[model samples]
Target: MTNNQRTEAVYIHIPFCTNKCFYCDFNSYVLKDQPVMDYLRALDHEMELTVKAHPPGAIKSIFVGGGTPTVLKPDEMEYFLHSVKRHFPVWSDDIEFSMEANPGTTDLEKLKVMREGGVNRISFGVQAFQNSLLSGIGRIHDTDDVYRSLDNARAAGFDNMSIDLMFGLPNQTLEMLAESVDKALELRLPHYSIYSLKVEENTLFHTMYQKNQLPLPDEEDELNMYLLLMERMKAAGYKQYEISNFAKPGYESRHNMTYWRNEDYYGLGAGAHGYINRQRHVNIKGVNPYNEAARTGLPRLESFEVSREEAMEDFLMVGLRVLDGISRTRFEQQFDASLDEVFKRPLSKMVSAGLLETTEDGYRLSSKGILFGNEVFAEFIGTLSAN
Candidate 1:
């Protein structure tokens, strides 16, 4: 069995945005006429109840995500950050405090507020570097906003920064993606997360797709886009640490590593999901409902315990996403069982099929496996029984 230890990571959510993007299905509402302060107070209460129940360790990482966290007014941001420190008082000396921002939202004063509040890293949602693509995707900001925001972030004393880019966008071509990549690399940020667009349910993209209005790249074109990005990022000296994420050495996202490693973290605020002591819980999704629910207790929409078999499967599904792959010693430490013994069947089959290669530490996806990652991950799900 895994040893008992307090969680060392925290994730806070801010569910307000200036406007919802066409492709985004995240739990966020437009910022007009919303009870911003009331929501912050509710989040503060949630943090209080959480720490009292589980008692956090010296927090090694804190990531404040949102529809657009930088959209918060400076006063509201200050209040929220102060509350975070008050509840989880102890922090590691080198704690990674990250906040997600969007172009056109993070002005110099707002960013300085964030830095003063202990946010040391910023991830901007600069989906593409083209003005037409930005407008087509329902983004309010253009390429100019991207450059100006990066400049402001730097002026506000932020050097450790990252930006997101998208591939397989509607009406996007191989040439378009290449141009976006060139502009992104020009910024020379420490980290980059480039993802292929997925048409998830309840988003405008899904509606358009069903009506045959969305003109997304074809499958072959999408595959080429992924391959092109991998080669370019490698040539530019960025390591493809995960399938879609590339970073300079030691600049990987530590907060995300907690989830990939299947560790516990405190998830607070509306629409946030938290896993602690083997139990997972998702807070209420709606803003007013969440505010009301946190008044008395934990605002959990649903809570459940993760079974050992499921946890083991998850260990493979997420751990293998890292380029270095899961560690054998780490697996043994968590499950008190040998990695080879527990997953002998799937391990042997995958190795035989040439999708997974054995490492000195454990198992990782081969080059071919990276292209067909979904099939490899699907192999492990529901394959284990609760013995």
Candidate 2:
């Protein structure tokens, strides 16, 4: 593929995990007996071919997300990072290089290699502070492991760190969530991402839900959990930059913002998805198939151009996720039609219903709309079908 637009962000997916979580529907597999090295080499090859085809503008962000990137041994991590540096040689001076880690998987040696290899930020998957809750979710790490891992990460020269927490867990209570929040705030890390557990298809949680065996929190309790967390985060002085993410000033996740802003990015590795040159491409998902295909060429399972209408819908859906909302000028510039002209009906309806508040520059979710974001987003869908 030829392109004049310079891609500035890259997302690398690692498909191997120590163990799959009960609720995770992500494309990840358990790491035992897997062709780990071969997959890395294939990923290297994919990056080589991709950069050559699309080239790049000084990449501003690189996110290594996974089944668990830290699961790679020190030498393996070194080799993997070497391949990354070799392929995407040019990076901005302040490039946000981030890697996702599982608490139990990281050690001093591995973290040292990761830091020295250009990983400036580490996000640990510390789902909760309670040991029972941790095991209930199939996570190996307990509260103690969370502390040890953070200490090791800091010792390895990583001060830019973040931890992920989850609420509305099985058998979780309001008091338990409050304790988790208190512990997370006590860490005083630069960023924190707390999400509610969604029972997705093909996961253990889904099966349990089908059998009416999952002990999930009721709607009222879940809503209270969200409200409580937001209140706590604000009181603690972290900006609610995104619905699920909070950060100190200048510490928001630039890589994730790239997606919420509906910009193009290169997705590499098995089961990765990329949006470039107006088309979206998904790579072959299975590890073996991806490795084989990468040896020859792009391991793409599908690549299709995104329709203009579809792009507009995506712009509204994702842009609203950010606290800043969608820019009317940007929408007009991108589509060459006024945002009002394009989404007049939904815009009017949402505003009248107090779900959206119009600003001089754009439209954003009203305070009430933030709580009912899905409903607001749904209004934008299919509005262009009549056009």
1-387: candidate 2 lDDT, tens digit per residue: 125668999999999999999999998989999899999999999999998988888999999997898999999999999999998889999999999999989999999999999999999999899999999999988999999999999999999999999999999999999999999999999999999999999999999999999999999999999999999999999999888999999999999999988888999998999988778999999999999999999999999998889889889999999988899888876778788888888999999999999888889999899889999999888777446
Off by over 4 Å in 1: 1-3, 385-387
Candidate 1, run of 10 with poorest lDDT? 1-10
- My TM-score estimates for the predictions, one after another, are 0.98, 0.98
lDDT, residue 42, candidate 1: 96
lDDT by residue (119-177, candidate 1, tens digit) is: 99999999898899999999999988999999999999999999999999999999999
After superposition of all CA atoms, the RMSD between model 1 and the true structure is 1.1
lDDT comparing candidate 2 with the true structure: 0.92
